[model samples]
Target: MAGHTHRQLAVLRAAAAGHVEMTCSREPHLYVDGLACCDPTLGHQLAGLLAPEPAAPRGPGLRVPAVLTAAGQAALAPSAAA
Candidate 1:
């Protein structure tokens, strides 16, 4: 969690729970708990934690299906154990 802040961890946890969504755009955006995250770099920060699903016919800026990666799951483990 060195590189991840509280908000970042929350986003990861939400993603792990399938409560997060992202858009496929030049600058991808992340939405947590059905609400948009104001941070523009949120997608980049969580890139390592996200595994994109198969390519879909989504228009620019449309929602892109994604799943949490092993790293993402691990990221939330410490908190869960606490």
Candidate 2:
């Protein structure tokens, strides 16, 4: 997963918790719908992370969005000071 993707997912997931709506393009690009704001490079990074790994290869090119897993979220919550 790309580092940018991880950051984007982190941002999105954080927003989601606050009931902020988001949208993912057909290409799986994420967007902050109403806000009409997003960092292009960050979006690409996030998309790369979210992409599935190739069936035969391993390593880079494996888009695995570093979306916060439930456990990760729980861990982050306290630090978020929310």
Candidate 3:
């Protein structure tokens, strides 16, 4: 099961709340346009959290595509799940 840490999830959620868009590079690295409020650690954390399982092999380092799921968007909303 792929899972993210609470902090990582929080960053992702926050990003969505701020209307920041995320995308994955060809190298499979997640990038956020309005993530100035979030630190590198938070980004790394989010990447790790949303990363695929080890068996799947998502590439090098802790970088991956930054596409958030519907549940992730919902979680980012302050009025939604925290």
TM values, all candidates: 0.73, 0.31, 0.32
- lDDT of model 2 at position 27: 39
Give per-residue CA lDDT, model 1, range 1-82, as digits (tens): 6667998887877776778778877667887777888898988878878755556557777886667888887777766555
Residue 18 error for model 2, in Å? Answer: 6.1
User: In model 3, where do residues sit more than 4 Å from their true spots?
Assistant: 27-67, 73-82
Query: Which lDDT value does model 3 have at 65?
Result: 33
Estimate the TM-score for candidate 2. Answer: 0.31
Q: List per-prediction Cα lDDT, in the order shown.
A: 0.76, 0.40, 0.46
The full ranking of all candidates by lDDT, starting with the best, is 1, 3, 2
- Count clashes in each candidate, considering only residues at least 3 apart in sequence or on different chains: 0, 6, 2
Candidate 2 lDDT, 1-82, residue by residue in tens = 2222455546556543542322333333333433533654544444333322224233433323224345435434545444
User: Could you tell me how far off, in angstroms, the CA of residue 24 lies in candidate 1 after the best superposition?
Assistant: 1.4
The residue pairs that clash in candidate 3, if any, are: 4-49, 13-76
